[model samples]
Each structure stands twice: as structure tokens, then as C-alpha cells.
Target: MKSFLTILFFVAITAFSTDTVQSQTFPKMDTSPMDLAMARPDRNTPPIARVIYSRPQKNGREIFGELVPYGKVWRTGANEATELTIYEPLKVNETVLQPGTYTLYTIPEEDMWTVIINKNANVWGTVYKKENDIVRLETPARNAAAPAESLSMVFRPENNGATLMIGWDKTYVEVPFEKVK
Candidate 1:
């Protein structure tokens, strides 16, 4: 009986161990990692706006007009489309954007980029609909002083609000935002 009990215990341990190993198949880390950028008047103040996006590495490959393609809407980053959250009403290119969460999409070009603010937020992939667009404005794109290995976005505070700076590879663009009156 003792021998029989020992065999049962061994069987139970093996079965549980096998189940544990099979149940946990950890996924590999993403090549493109998600990141966040925010704008604030000062370090002690609350953020006026925030952006969440993924930073995709250049990997020594062509970026703009090639990997990203020109005249096409890009997610602005890898994986999920970039998300923008506005804490207060702000104006972009004279157009007022009410306080809310939005998606930032861009139509890349050789010398210019069309920035689009959409109503949808936190959606997966680059699934875009023209009807959801809130505003679209043109911003000039220029070559960066040095190649950026990863996609990056930063907000610089101004007297009115802030300017959103986006750079990838060897190109960068600035989008200005001002507090609404």
C-alpha cells in the first residue's frame, strides 16, 4: 500500500508540472516598445496634453518615403496608433480642439506632412475612417541633424500652450498647439 501511495504521488507531481509548463508560454518582448510624452507649463503643474505611442527602431533601414511611405496615413508609430489626450481646449492651426482624447495620424510627404486629429482613441492598428477626423493641418517636415534610431515625440511649452515635436530616422516635424480663448 505504501509503494502504491508513492507511485500515485509521483504521478500527481508529474501531471501538475507538465500542466504548469504548458500553460505559461511567455511571449517575446516587442521590437517596438510603447512610450509616453506630455506637455506642461512647469514641472509643478499638471500636464496640458499627453501622447502615448510606440517607438520603432530605424534598424538601418529607410524610414520616410520608403518604410513609412509618402502620401499615406501612418499610425505615427508602430503597433497601435498614437493616442493624444487633451486636458483643456487648445487650438491647432487656428482650429480649436475641445478637451478630449484623440488619435494622431499623419500623412507623410517628401517635404510636408498632413497631421490629422481624429476622435477615436486607444484603437489597435491603423484602422482610420474619414468621418472620425476632427481636424487636418499641414506641417513642414525637415531632415534631422542626426538620424534617430527610434521614433520619438516631445512637447515644448510655449506662452500659449505647447509644440509637439516628432522625429524618426532623419526627419522631424513640429505641430503647434495654443490654448483656446
Candidate 2:
């Protein structure tokens, strides 16, 4: 009888220990990306684009199209759209986002260029953000430039160093520094 009780006691202890150990779950952060195609190829190459960023980005206030402007399609992030790159899925301004990829487009002016996130993954380039899926988050665009017509999806690395620059014509707009992991 004593041995039986001892066995039962040990079983209970092991069960409790196993439950305690197994119950612990890793905490999850609220970062959900929309995960769309970051880049595509030229007409013949079938090129593939990769995702780039530092890690741990900031979510700030301001309507995307307001501070960011209205009209042009944006890359959604510093360079490309892959989930949170679209609207609601990932917070662009101070707004809470859902998580999804979007093609970003814009209409450039003196101050802002109406940053937009489109739903189209297969595009010729950062061309028509308006004609794609219109979901979005607006952020203020910054003034940065390269002399000639630079490719749109570029991340110039620096400190935490991540900048998504769109340069076509002499004019340019930048969505700076995204913390990526």
C-alpha cells in the first residue's frame, strides 16, 4: 500500500511538472506583414526580388495619404510590399494594421506624393498604384534624390540604415528607415 501511494505521488509530481513546463508559450509581437512580391524581373529574365530591412520598425501617427500625400502608389514600406506593406494589415501611420502585401504607388508634387498600396503583385514596375487594390496606410514622404532615373525599390543601408527611395525624373520621394528582421 505504501509503495502504491509513493508511485501515485511520483506520478502526480511528474504530471504537474510536465504541465508547468509545457504550458509556457512564447509571446508573439503584433507584427503581421502582408507578404507580397517585393520585386519582379525584366520581360525576359524572370527576375526575383528579395525582402530587405534592418529589424524593429516604428509605427507613427498621420494619415498615409495626408503626410505621405495622395495619387502615386507606394512600395508600402521602405522598398517593397509584402503584407503589412498594404493597409490595415500593417500600420503605416499610427493606425493598427491587419497584415498583407500591397504594391505601393505615389503622385509626386512639391511636398508629398500620395503614397498608395495596391493589391497587384505582378506589375511591370512601381507604375500604377491607383489601378491596383486601393487598401493603404499613409505616411509623410521625405525629399531624397539621385540625379538620373533610379530604380524604385532601393534600400540605401546606413545606421539602422534602411531607406526605400523612389526616383523617376529629377524628382524623388523617400520612405525612410524600416526595422526588419
The candidate scoring highest on TM-score is: 1
**TM-scores for the candidates:** 0.86, 0.37
* lDDT for position 140 in model 2: 47
- Model 2, span 45-116: residue lDDT tens: 331233333111223423334543455444434433423242212233333323454455555445556555
The reply for model 1, stretches above 4 Å from the true place, is 1-26
Lowest summed lDDT across 10 adjacent residues in model 1 is found at 121-130
Report every candidate's CA lDDT: 0.94, 0.44
lDDT of 1: 0.94
Model 2, TM vs. native: 0.37
- The local distance difference test score of model 2 is 0.44
- Residue 35's C-alpha lDDT in candidate 1? 97
